[model samples]
Target: MRQSRFEQAFLAYLCTMDVLITVVSWLASYFISSLAWSLDFYPQQGETPPFWWCLRTVPAVILVSLLSYRLSGLYQLGRRWPLWQEVFHVLKATGLMLLLLVATTFFARNPYESRLASVIFLALTSVGLVLGRRCWGIYFRLRRRWGLVDSKALIVGTGRLAKNLDVALRSNNWMAMEPMGFIDDGVHSSVGRATQTVGGIEDLPKLVEEHGINCVFVALPLSRYAATKKILRLLRDTLVEVRLIPDVPALTPLAVQIGELEGLPTLNLRSSPYSFLDGLLKRTVDVVFASLGLVVISPLMGLIALIVKLSDGGPIFYGQERMGLDGRKFLMLKFRSMRVNAETESGPVWASQGDQRRTRFGAFLRETSLDELPQLFNVLRGDMSLVGPRPERPYFINNFRESIPKYMLRHSVKAGITGWAQVNGWRGNTSLRKRIQYDLYYITNWSIWFDFRILFMTVRAMWDKHAY
Candidate 1:
């Protein structure tokens, strides 16, 4: 079937609600700002613009808000986002809308130039949009429970992947997709006993017509390519919408993106998640925060350096070659946390608890993660990001890349002083597989908010027991 009527109606409703909220927020903000100014709360040179003059910008505000929300993926059809995630999306869209308004205000000859009013509009619109979406979600859930928005889906496989997808769909009942049953050429023993095979693949079109199936999900494995092609060809004659659930191997941690090159469809299996704008924003934050961090903690670093030197007269700063983005070698810096030549006899090895190689001050530094302070310079120098997969020594990387699947995928982004793995207690001698899993997760889900979260978690993880 085509896009569901419910989804279309919901989208239109959301757009209408957003437009109404924007206009109401603008008007409310104008009146509130005038009230504040008259009460001496907001001191200004003159009275605020007339109501009709402020109303002149309502259309612009609504247009910008809708465009921002659309760009933020708020209008994506059939999205079953959790309430909190939807609210966050609304907040982001509202923020972007305000930014666009401010940027255009610089060029537009509008008489309504009250910064206080703009601020009030931002707050009012954000709250209004979030509450509006939440209320709609609740109403949608009620409607879904009444079976008014249910969409019947048919699965085209009976394998483990198909069973997993069924479980996922059922667990997310908010999507209102009911799995009718499976259709496979032959039932496998691994198929879930609860969801039996409805019929062979030959019955697909008949089942679709009889059951009024709205969607068909093909969760076949790669080994069944021929059968999958046949199924697609059969689906072509039917009205049900088709969705392919590629059973990609676990080794590929990065998300798959569809690309077109010269009219040939391509699947980007190995790709950096960052867009150019995302990279620029991340780099800007890295440089600004790294610089401020270095300056703020320079004195403490100096004191640590003095202690390390006075303890054993070793180098104050330790620099080691580590692999970073795209497997490039960079000198990662740290305050000296071990005696000179501590690893000479043993060769490069991971630090262990109660290790004899650490000096008295070095042990304290390592325990508290003070040794990682110098890596802020690495961030400033563009050798790493403020948050990402922790860089590993070349000796370890060479072996890990050979034996561990998708280990090199972590290098898709810059190494970080503190990372998702580190903050999640996967640092030091923790499970390499779990650390790699978290690292890949960070890369695929990289966002400014995610970076800030990791940084905050890193502070709380300073005394993590996993640290040596």
Candidate 2:
């Protein structure tokens, strides 16, 4: 995930708090006169904290705060406003720490221990420190972005591309990049298009001087090699930043994507599900919900196993190795969904309605999703997640891989028992292209809310038309 300014501020604030507390405590201890104190709460004269306590605890507090920073994404640098998210991180961390600390303190003493200061120290310092950093950070970001202070930019090519870029710069509320209009190589349509083309390619010097263009982008077409070279040579005299946007390749399979290497801007041809934060968040949700399901339904799972074994005095679980998650093999377990000898005849064909291979109990279990209960254990085992592209048999995967454009992209992440396709009625014998499209969508827009929605729909559509 990209780092954000709020996170930086939060980190800064955490550091400030450590320094504030340590300095305040030390100064107060050193400066306060014992003549003004009573035995009620005052430490006797010369009973102040040893210098070593401040040395050790202050650094320890700062170290702990930094660790908390990593968990909270307080160091995650990004451009957006980090509103309550920073506060949420701080609170979650502080609460977890407080619980741990209280436990540790209790363990240190039998009954009576110092908890009064602990409560005050946690409540006031944590809130004050985090909020102060947030306030200062927001102000800093705003000053750098929206205030007249900003990074100046210039586009070298003219046309729809330059116009679009100009519009983006103009409309962007964050005052980060200020676009100084087009620098054309000739007095063609390109010049007319770029906010009144700041003259021709020869006028680069004048354009930079007049409009104060600090950053130069060479958005030149492949055909304009000679002109682009000339412009580069001309730019040697100016102390301006130069960026080249190669027309043909860069414009072809492109839009912005996360984790894209900035230097190799021309050779971007692959697609990923979500760019950055979205992917991480989806995985996070998968871990949480899958872990929860495994924990809660564990007993019911045992009952299912028992029922399967008693039905035909056969194996309770079926462990069929399936291709999943970047082409790795893992035995997918489920309550036995067929007679012990079911696959002896036709092998692993897709189950059909009233299929003779399926045991009477197997049909019920499949219909009710009880057969999937064992997959909760699979989730725990790290072979699968709660939601994602459902794994297919190797036979089907091999067959589809040839026909599908980016079929293997599905295996980029762990397979799931339930998925966007299942909830959207694309499960069962659906079109491979459409199913892959849904899988790609799950990969791209995956988020906590999306997974939660998919799960909610999955539960609602348990007896859906396509389930059979």
Candidate 3:
């Protein structure tokens, strides 16, 4: 496969921008510092110190600017453009860079360094750098459209998405992408009249040779992982760039992303929403909190145990196998809220209002959600988090997976003792669809603040009307 001249040029521009932004951002730092001094933001009289002092502020500004760009993805040129997303980003990056400079000055008390000068440098430099790059982007994009830079693309796998992608690629002419045709996989083959399936997946070499294909996009289904893998492996010998469009089941429940390992694409089927340092911190919180909870509630747990034993001579503790991250099964602990072996007859039935298995003492525990308290042990065991989407029974998960798209996406993160579903009062015989919807929201927008909010809500929802 041939390499597109346009892509080469665009990459060159990106590299140039990375260097240009660094240099210009650093230089502007000095001028900004002087300006801050003039504005009385700096100390009026500071000792004229060694020139090495200036280097401190300059390096800090440059590092922060690079971080801002990297995190904001300022260099991913192909991201949706033509809207004010670029302008919005520019404003944000520039503002953050300036704020960072202020913090550094406040932290470092140096006699020679002018805190005022640093702020001025950061503000002016950031504004100039971001705005300048944006203007260049607009111009470069417009110029690339005129066949000045273009990529002849061959998309493998035909369907509405490919058709739409083809139209978008063609219409955004400045992107320099030209769709040659759609190569339908062995499945559906309504590739349209203008398009033809040059050859089967095996004949990709000949197709690439004949069409002079510059790019090969594997827009196949994720369910066809084997086929997608084969197509990728076969294309390795070709020079053409390869891109994949994830299948619908893998695509939905948006905001999730595929991770890579040593250049091989991988489904991040499991992730501890908190990783490395944060994970260590969250676990510390869980262990310390759960241990205290056990100590504080031991007497009450004992009282509940006696009542359950007296009522039906049932097992004091309930141990139900539930699905955890990556579909691993773990025994989730709870106070007994039903007959000793409730699932002995029919398996995995939902606990309905006035469930037949709910003995006299069991009903009280269920109503107060004391039945779920022992799951604090699940948290201590590391099978669950103090806060997250509630882990469902394997039986229900299997049932839901068949009907839901990306249903297991929630399992990517740790299962929770109490979750968005419980907080929303959607647990236990409530709408499964609504519960899953909340579960998805929690998965997508997860953050420390979100976890805290869910924890707060769980407390409030304990007495909630819907909590039976």
Candidate 4:
């Protein structure tokens, strides 16, 4: 669809701002480098480039930056585009532009006026570009919230899916999508649902014309094959964007991927997180974090070990079999927080609040979650991840899998020392069903930043009520 005058004006403003920001960033980067190191501190005996001489490259840098952002799709960002993704693309474009600037200088047989200044410019501009785009996005979001222009949306079929989608769009005001109403023969009265019923599928085209619907969503059930086909055929003449909501509301899909299998479209429902590059990135982060954590906390861990060993002259470390990724069992290590035979007779019983089996120091360790420090080694050994679903014992897994739905799905990813469930107070004999829900949510929404947030929350929740 052709963009409106407002959208075109917005895009033009963004382009103009991009050029201005690039110029400012180039100068700012050079100024920062000057403050950090003397411009006369050159690697070779070439004349120190004066400010004007260095400024000559700013125009070229700005041109290349604009081209890079255009190629990176930064200019095509919409209101719905994720801020993180936009920032990432902006940073990538800035890096490319910097590389281009360096290459151009090298090709010209006159290396950068000042190598240090060039490096500083790249670092400064990369950060500035991302911040600039973020500010732009924030301004638009605020404007949209204050009754700016919004896309008119029409939802076909007034089923549960349609109602849910309506509620979601209406609740998230930042979405900037105004759902007009539903168009289904089943729903005649709209006393409680999303507004009044506009009309059935028969009146869809007229409604679109009269209501100025720019976006149409077909949310009818999959069972109504005839109705769905007829609706699509009717809407074919309209120039609106039509989207079909797949009728699979019962299944909870984690990391869904759409691909072609033998020339046929296939929707993967149960996609795992450890696929190719994602797996590599996750493992690489895990190893780096685990190595650093073990080094920094070694002294504290040693002290805990000493205390546990002296409490009863028993083993300092306890290793227990627990289920992990792909249902594989691994010996999870932790500081001993119980008597020698605390669970020998009872056999795999969950420790409760104020459990008498715990030693005095052990109780403190359990309360503070210091007992789980040894699992950092497990992360290093690749038996677990720094963040994932908390591993459960085989004894309880056997029971939960039989009783609870999707209980074993938590094992789809590597178990972790602390998980979304634990930080959210679902640890140590809490509701198993709720734990499974949070574990699955974490798996589906896994990202480096998400992992960092969970880690921060874990540290903040050190004295949590459910730690025991």
TM-score of every candidate relative to the true structure: 0.91, 0.60, 0.55, 0.79
Ranking of all candidate structures by their TM-score, best first: 1, 4, 2, 3
How many collisions between residues are there in candidate 1?
3
Give the number of the best model, judged by lDDT: 1
Q: What residue runs in model 3 are displaced by over 4 Å at the alpha carbon?
A: 1-45, 48-52, 55-154, 160-323, 326-349, 354-381, 394-412, 418-426, 430-466
Residue 287 lDDT in candidate 4: 93
Q: Per-residue alpha-carbon lDDT of model 2 for 1-468, expressed as tens digits?
A: 323343345556656664575345433433332222334354443443344443334444445545554665544443333455556555666655555545544564423223343445566645764666666556656765555644677777776566666765555434355665676755544333235565677888777777677777777667665677788788888887776655543432222343437654334444554547766676677677778877888898878888888888999889988988879999998889888878787976777667788788898887777787788778877888888889888977878889887788788777998999888888776777999988877776555556678888988878766544
Clashing pairs in 2: 3-76, 3-77, 3-78, 4-76, 4-77, 4-78, 7-74, 273-444
Q: Rank order by lDDT, top first?
A: 1, 4, 3, 2
Instruction: Give model 2's TM-score versus the native structure.
Output: 0.60
> Of 1 and 3, which scores higher on TM-score?
1
Question: How far out, in Å, is residue 160 in model 3?
Answer: 5.4
- Measure candidate 3: CA RMSD: 8.0
Tens-place lDDT per residue, model 1, 1-468, is 235665676668879998999889989999999999889997988656788878788778878888898988877754466666777887888889989987776679766678898889988988898888778767756775687646888888887788888887765544677788888886634355356678888889899999899988998877885787788787788878888888865437687666889988788888888878889999999999988998899899889888888888879999999999999999999888888999889999999999998888888899999999999999988999999999999999889988998899999889998899999999999999999999989887777888999999989999988788
Give the per-residue lDDT digits (tens) of candidate 4, residues 1-468: 255544567678778877887788678766666655554453435444567756777677767887888876676633344667666666778778877877876786554466676667666766776777667657756765676646788888777788877776665443456788888876677822446677888888888889788888887776764687788788889987777777664565466666887988887777786668778988999999999988999899888888888888999999999999999999999899989988978778888898888889989998898998999899989999988999989998888899999887788889988789988988887898898889988988787677888999999888878766
Candidate achieving the largest TM-score = 1
> Where is model 1 poorest over a 10-residue stretch in terms of lDDT?
186-195
lDDT of each: 0.84, 0.66, 0.70, 0.78
Residue 57 lDDT in model 3? 57
